[model samples]
Target: MTEEQLDKLRLDGTKVRVVRDALELNDVVGFVVAWDDENVLIRRPNRRVVKLKRSYAIVPASEPRPDVLTEN
Candidate 1:
């Protein structure tokens, strides 16, 4: 994402769901804390901060949860 996009997410203080399919990892639901060109820092509900690559997909948490996610 560009700096503008990241700034928007950061400014809104929105909760987001990040998916890392390439790594076969579980989704992370959290708030955007900070970001740079290559990495985004997110703070999870448990207050743990995680650094993720910008290549991963990040979606707004306000959207309806996908059926597949709930079924799991």
Candidate 2:
């Protein structure tokens, strides 16, 4: 994604599915907390934080749930 897209996601508190490696099926579902040119920090439902390279494929998931929308 472009920096603008990432910035939008970060600002909107949108949930994303991050695909680290398609071959290995490594991915995470969470909302981006912060991002720089090199990396992004995501917080999962369990309150666990994951740091991912900016090159990873990060896409929007389903629409935010009502509770999630209210919480943010």
Candidate 3:
């Protein structure tokens, strides 16, 4: 995401789901705490902060509901 977009997420204090590695499809769910040009710090539900690359895919936590729930 762009810097402006990231800043919005951070400012909004929105819980976000970050895909640090698309290949693994492992999601790190957290709130955007801080960020720089290269990395972002996410405060996880466990109250731990994780630093991830700015290039990673980040989305609002409430979105992207499970497919099982969406499917009939």
Tens digits of lDDT, candidate 3, 1-72: 887888899888889988654333578898998888899999999999999997767889888733432333
Clashes of each: 0, 0, 0
- Against the hidden reference, what TM-scores do the models get? 0.77, 0.73, 0.75
Better of 2 and 3 by TM-score: 3
**Would you list the clashing residue pairs of candidate 2?**
none
Given candidate 3, what's the lDDT at residue 34? 86
lDDT, candidates in the order shown = 0.80, 0.76, 0.80
User: lDDT, candidate 1, residue 56?
Assistant: 76
Misplaced by over 4 Å in model 1 are 22-25, 64-72
Evaluated at residue 39, the lDDT of candidate 2 is 91
Sort by lDDT, top down from the best: 1, 3, 2
Ranking the candidates on TM-score from highest down gives: 1, 3, 2
lDDT of 2 by residue, 17-63 (tens): 88665342466888988888899899998999999898766778673
